[model samples]
Target: MGQESLQAFQHQVGDVLLRHRSFLDVSSKYQESNGRVNRAITKAVTECGCLRIEAGCQPFEEAIALSEMKNRFDTHLTGHLCDHCLDTVKEELGKNLFYMTALCNLLDIKVEEVIEKESKKLSTLGIFNLR
Candidate 1:
């Protein structure tokens, strides 16, 4: 999808959505939705055992070139999500996006513009775009 599609989605969210029109409500819901997304992932790891996170400090070498850094970093994720877990995670993510878009609409900001700016920043900063 293009930028217009994202703008259209934001507009549609603002126009058709009835509840949580207030900025406070939308922002709270956005935060809640984000927690739900995190909880969903946690469940996939703990309850379902479909995934495992073996996270630690990433090994880094100053001598390695920036272009070769991609191969050294690890996600630490052990397994892919099963079908049920994938669906649950996707649903939670969708809800998170809905609330995020709602918040953006409340703030009169375009999601596409935000994404574009972030993309540009990442492209320009490359490995220096830490976090």
Candidate 2:
């Protein structure tokens, strides 16, 4: 799509989301054009509070559970365009952010710093398997 057209489309999506901003704190609300955080946001919506995450699940485990649930939701949504209900977007998004932000705060790490470090490591390893 043309840049202007894309911008307009994004604006409309934002408008739709803004209309119901209170219902869910979805990824679309916080994501830039980049797809990374958007994935997290979509995940938050799909997770809908029952991430099957045990209380004992570590951060990595929690992240994985959230991602898996998100992938399932993507598959299901792709097959159909059913309307959204009480999807745990808010809870999942809140928790996803809370855990990582908290971890970073405790570790004295900025997200940018972490990303840069990992990017360098991946470059050194000559791998880009960032799934």
Candidate 3:
């Protein structure tokens, strides 16, 4: 994405995070330890490109993006993930797919093309079998 589009996406993600903060906070309090939640948030933010380095320090945008993605993933996928189970993982993956599809639609991106490209990337990473 171009820089302007990327910034808009980040802002929209931030808004989504803000809208769901209360729910996320309450859910996280009961569902997992703070450390795990933090780790998950960090991972999601980094993966989403919400986190960026500026003068060797992270900015407010990164923090907001991290919080948003963390809440989104936790709310949607956390309970579905398990170390030894593929069924739950598959369900969660489906949820993620639906979410990204919706996001692409909202952003006016081509959902099918993006999904095809992202599916290839995920398949290459061996994260999941999209086939």
Best by TM-score: 1
TM-score of each: 0.92, 0.30, 0.27
- Could you give candidate 2's per-residue lDDT for residues 46-110 as a string of tens digits? 55432222234323344555435534332223222123422333444544554443444434456
Which TM-score value belongs to model 1?
0.92
Model 2: CA > 4 A from native: 1-91, 128-131
Q: Which stretches of candidate 3 lie over 4 Å from their true place?
A: 1-84, 115-131
Decide which is better by lDDT, 1 or 3: 1
**Prediction 2 TM-score vs. true:** 0.30
Q: Rank order by lDDT, top first? A: 1, 3, 2
lDDT of 3 at 71: 40
lDDT of 3 at 70: 37
Clashes of each: 0, 3, 0
Candidate 1: stretches off by over 4 Å: none
lDDT by residue for model 1 (30-115), tens = 89999999999999999999999999999999999887888999999999999999999999999998898988887788899889
Alpha-carbon shift of residue 127 in model 2 (angstroms): 3.4
- Quantify how close model 1 is to the true structure by its C-alpha RMSD in Å: 1.3
lDDT by residue for model 3 (1-131), tens: 56566556545544564433454453443244434445544444444433432233222354555425434332222332233344433544544443453455445566446656876887786523322
User: What overall lDDT goes with each candidate model?
Assistant: 0.90, 0.43, 0.45
